[model samples]
Target: MVAVGYTLMCEQAGPKQLVDYAVRAEDAGFGLAVVSDHYYPWLESQGHSPYAWSLLGAVAQATSRIDLMTMVTCPTRRYHPAVVAQKAATMGLLSDGRFTLGLGSGENLNEHVVGAWPHVQERHEMLEEALQIIRPLLDGETLTYSGDHFEVPEAYLWDRPERPVPIALAASGPSSVDLAGEYADALINTEPDPHVIDLFDSAGGAGKPRYGQVAICYGPDEEQCRKIAHEQFRWFGLGWKVNADLPGPESFDSASSFVREEDVADSIPCGPDLEAHVAAFKRFVDAGFTHVAVVQVGDETQPRFLDWARDEFLPRLRQL
Candidate 1:
């Protein structure tokens, strides 16, 4: 069976909040911890985007059994892949070999904080060059190279992990997906749709497992949950005029004109209900997602999230 896990979108509140959540997640019966890795938030107005690697280091020292990962780490534009490899290797050591490296081509909005904007195609091209260097460096091999996109002469990891760390790549388009199968051990994606998984596999990941995450809100009241989810994810439904463009949650902008404020109610799960969550998760499972995570957050759910997981969601989900 694919073991159930707890995925944390770290609150960046403080030390106590971070420690307490990691502990509670472990106690709540999670077999894995998928954390987000980002240099900055999508919108500074949203809140703080704590340094993810620093937090992951703290998490490593705090927990023992739960497998740790940066749900997905973006290696292009912001931090050098060499730096990421070093941090990831150290964390893997601290976690006693329980950590995995998750990678991606990344988004311009997040990456542009340090560098200039690049189109989607250019971003993927950079990512390709990044992985080529990152994977070898992490393996603790001496490097000597000069490439159009990147270069390293006599560079290699000294404090590499106890064992080779598994590298997973995230991609949404055909070229990136094909490159993933050719160079990566696994795949990650925001949309947990199976069709995309099939596409990646056809390109190369024939025997690899795919991990995905979908957003949902849980609360004591269903209506309350929907309101919270819609406010956060309406951007997804907002982007495209047609619903088919987005089969998943995001802040998509739709409507030729001002969008009638989106109703989040249909987007997330709320209240003490179990049926809806079970049904919602099934969409991911049916799509061939072997490892899955539920993005459950918001003020109402964040503080008592573990309690809810232990008392509610897990009971219903484990049965499936």
Candidate 2:
């Protein structure tokens, strides 16, 4: 059976509210939960970006059953890999082995705040090095390493779970997918494309859990849903290449100025159609994703969406 999960969008929700949402998601029957780690909201109108690690710590205490993970944290620049290993290790213990560390090469919007922006290839190289440093530390090993991209001098995680936290690497292309196959316990992708699954499996990710995220809006009014999705998430239409390069909200706003309601509607399922929501997720299942995270687009509609998910959506999805 495919594992259904809920997305706790930290960029769109406050810390306490996000913690509460995790509890609600567990009650709603979601087996896993993923949260975005962002320094700033994609669009200022969306209006929030709390510290993801701190919020996750609270979530670990608040929820008992649901699995938690970072949809993707960039351990390359804004924070060092050693720091990420430490934090993730603590989280694993706090959640009693329920935490997974999802990592990516990162984007300028979040990693640029520290005032250095490397080229795309350089970032990927940095990510590989970061993973090398993180993996051993999570296994409770002390390590010293000097790499072209990173340096560590006798670093070790003082507190760790009995087992190493699972690492899920985010991939949007073949190169990253291959990296994930070689290094990660799982693979995470935003799109529901079978080609991605094919590439991952061919590159040695066969039998590993493939994770995906689907964005949608749930409400009674279609027009309102379209408007909300367009306002809050149109930045997503820019594609990863552009999304990774853009430095801030202003750049995203300028880039998405031409985005219309139709564009948003086409990308994210909207309104009260139960089949639309199920179909949106089915795309991932069809693509061979073993785990999927559904992100409800608007903050105001979260409670209603969760209620509907528990009562309507999840039950039907499980049968699929």
> Which candidate leads the pack in lDDT?
2
Candidate 1 residue spans exceeding 4 A from truth: 11-16, 43-45, 236-263
Query: On a 0 to 1 TM-score scale, where does candidate 1 land against the true structure?
Result: 0.88
Across 166-260, the per-residue lDDT of candidate 2 in tens digits comes to 99999979899989988899999999999989998988999999999999999999889999999899998899999999999999999999999
TM-score against truth, every candidate: 0.88, 0.98
Residue lDDT tens for model 1, 2-56? 5566666653244456656777788887777888765443322234456678878
TM-score of 2: 0.98
Task: State the displacement of the C-alpha of residue 114, model 1, in Å, after optimal TM-score superposition.
Answer: 0.5
lDDT of 2 at 262: 98
Tell me the RMSD of model 2 versus the true structure. Answer: 0.8
User: Candidate 1, which ten residues in sequence have the lowest lDDT sum?
Assistant: 243-252
How far residue 39's Cα lies from its native spot in candidate 2, in Å, is: 0.4
Query: Distance (Å) between predicted and true CA of 198, model 2?
Result: 1.7
